[model samples]
Target chain A: MLKIKNLFLKKDNFILGKISFEIEKNSYCVILGKTGSGKTMLLESIAGIQNPEGNLYFDGKDISNISPNKRDFGFVYQDFALFPNMSVEKNIKFSARYKKIEDEKNLFLDLIEFLQIKDILKRDIKYLSGGEKQRVAIARAIYSRPKLLLLDEPLSAVDPTFRNSIMKSLKEIVQRYNTTIIHVTHNFREASYLADKIAVMLDGQILQIGDAKDVLNSPSSIEVAKFLGFKNIFSTKILGFEQKNKFFSIDPNKIDFLKEKCLDDYCFECKIEKIMGITDHYKIFATVKDTQSFFAKIPKQIFMELKLNEGDKSYIFINKKDVVFI
Target chain B: MKDKSFLIVFLFLGSIIVLFLMVPIMNLFYSVGVNNIFETLQDKETYESIFLTLKSSFFAVLFVCFTGIPLAYLIARYNFWGKSILESLLDIPVMVPHTAAGIALLISFNHGYIGDFLSFIGLEFIDTTIGIISAMMFLSAPFLINGAKEGFKKVDIKYEHVAQTLGASKLSVFLSISLPNAKNDILNGALMMWSRGLGEFGAVVIIAYHPMVAPVLIYDKFNNFGLKFSAPVAASMILVSICLFLSIRYINNKV
Candidate 1:
């Protein structure tokens, strides 16, 4: 329902461009990137709130040059941007005052009730907590029932407990309303959980865009894989693959975790370099045979059982079938 | 206590200035009883001068609102090549000698294209109520503009962006979101402009001395009949100033 083609933007020394993506009707698209990756700039460009050299098509209309007010898009800022002068109800009602999509009140009631902001509807914005402010901001944005919803790091400032519930409610609300969404965040976990299609952006360009699992499991390049924090990314030739596709590969099945250094089967002695915590999983980086460094993603139980620490010696088992050509 | 010596030093330094300011106003109040101020208010000329002062200053604030808000919004939100220069220029009226401002205004607005063009339009400023208002607005506009700029600066621009994405036009976002959020500072600016305009003397006297405001009338009374004649008018002006000051303080606290 929404397509951005060859979007180019230059702000000072930072440039973002050729950002092309399409979101299906009612689909959730997440723009994932690191800090200063121009993620928010791309979102603002698509929202038509910033100047960009590109074209955007929504519902078969070229809306590249239209004002933001005519875009029929909802935006949730990272800061929530709740109107301090208005109560929660009035802030939500403020958006409604500008545009009326239909002669319907049930949707507004559902939003207010489902977002769990009805209790604080009469309270001033200053008195609300961070989570409460986010709720109100979303309610205000959705009350207008815009065709597209653009969220710029909506979960960044939210408490962890509220973040999960907010994501769940947002997904449910989007499905119920049949609204397309594009969310920009530097957090991969949020993207993995919330996006139907994940677009990985680095610097100013998009490196990969596909299903969340596809991007995570097999990134297009080692750079993309490294950025996505894939544990094992290296240039290893596959035994049976054609010469054209044998150069880039990943070991899909995790390497075996060894408590003591043992050279048995496809085993190599290595020194632990770093351990990155990924939610409940653990990613261990170790140098193999003092020549090459490789990382292994193991279950937290296996990692704890081995009790590995940085700079400690360890061994890992690898198999031929574990290699997957990207 | 650890703070005792610091507290004593602070009190000693602060009380001297406080007493220096309070002594004259208190002595003025002691000399002019409430009966004198009340009798002065009974005079038609005293009432008209005070009323004219308020009326002109109110009109001055209205003019400032018309011309100053957009400039303030620009200064607060955008940066341009000469933005800093423009901001400093706005403050020049506040720093310049009022008598010099009067002389400059009188010369530029005296039978020149601007003055004659305005005269042809039947809106003369020389020795007229229009001149008083013009002088008041020229002298007081910086306050309103500066205060409003500070107010607009405090409002996060993200709200306007979000409002626009939520389908609010630029004007709608400004009116509904920006204005109401900055209402306190805007009101403060208006009060400052009005109060400053009410007390304007040098420019107003040079431009429109015949139709006197409260300050000009007191000055005239002092020059013609010495201290005794002007004391009651001064007391009445102080009473009005105190009332306005108290009301502003009360509203500020509530806000």
Candidate 2:
């Protein structure tokens, strides 16, 4: 397990303002954030590339004062900084030798076979493609058998078409090595696919942390919800409620379009304001009697069956189970 | 059409400069003639002076390489408090007049502190081959250091960091990665130092006029027997330097 507690780092104008998290062993934790949100700085601090002014423990051992090379963590930079003078095989062998591991040749061969870059072992680094270079860099990083792996925007440099395959390869390698990885990215799809637990970061602070679906479905704060593209959130007050909860949360997908529903505990009359077709689904926008506006995404076939149009009156239903109070 | 116009201008400028540079050297060869060149080569004194010039210059270049490469790498890689001051100090020898350089060396290595100490160890720098080599090194060492520093600066420091991460020691990285990358620049610096050493006259004449290098020999011959007697040796030295320069240029191109 990797634990960072009250980690504070101040350099120039950028600050990692009081970060704390625990990454369980062999779990893939993806940090999601916009640019200049301290995602890369946090990863660097974890890797021990730069010292932070707080406590960091790896598997219950303090590594706050450890040098980067001594931290036993593998780091993949965003640029895939391969040594230009060395061949692919030599580049992979460099870190292996640095860690003083025996059987370096066998390790090199294994990595080359795993990455499927055996054919280009003798080729110089400048000749490799983006994907190929990234594979070599990953191979070099993992060859030392580091306990922790840090990836700083690995797929951000590649083309969109190659991103999925590269990410899949990286995931497979990390699993095969049983390496605990802290992957950082700005892309939502990458975060959703890779993260067992997601930490949403903004402006040098982590706004929320939970399971990927949980964070996306119900964010902890307004800024986090908006950062995650939750478009229909509003400051609402409870009205005519027997259960005296302060607030309620609902997934737009779970809200049903009906006049009379027996299963739903909450119902409201709304007028359809706008309809938008979003690939394979329809996003319905509606206003609930001068209270607040909401959006519901439903499948295209189901939306066609309803034959809903703009300015049409409708009933929106929300089940109590779908409504989470936080 | 645009390329043709550029080509015409380039050729015109090139030919004018080439003619201006070659005419004086060609005049020496024309004066020596084919028969006189062979006759001059047959002389024992000509061979002796040529051999002395080559040997002393070779030693001077060797000394420059040993000291200059590391100093240049240090200046290029590290930022210290007095780095720019040290760099300017190195340029002082190159920019100062060679006659003043020889006078400075003479005063320092002449009598008391270092000179007498060295003389007690049977190494004197007065009217000896050592004096000639010392003079040449003083005038030429700056070329090697400046060239090598520029070369080292152009190499990416990330390569060294990567090597360090890979498990190589600092010395191993310098030898395998940095040295090989800077090979061309080192060779160029050596060639510059060697050429400068060969053409040294002002300092060599002031310090060691007895062990006559080719330049000093030519000067001596011109002073005693006029231009007619010195033309053959001058032409021979010019031809040798031109060939060496061209070969170095070719090697640089190949790299």
lDDT of 2 by residue, A39-95 (tens): 988987887666788899998999998766677787777887787667888877777
Model 2's DockQ?
0.26
Considering only chain B, what TM-score does candidate 2 achieve?
Answer: 0.94
DockQ scores for all the models shown? 0.79, 0.26
**Which CAPRI level is candidate 1?**
medium
Q: Candidate 2 chain A: worst 10 consecutive residues by lDDT?
A: A238-247
Off by over 4 Å in 1: A237-253, A257-286, A295-316, A324-326, B248-255
| Candidate number of the best TM-score | 1
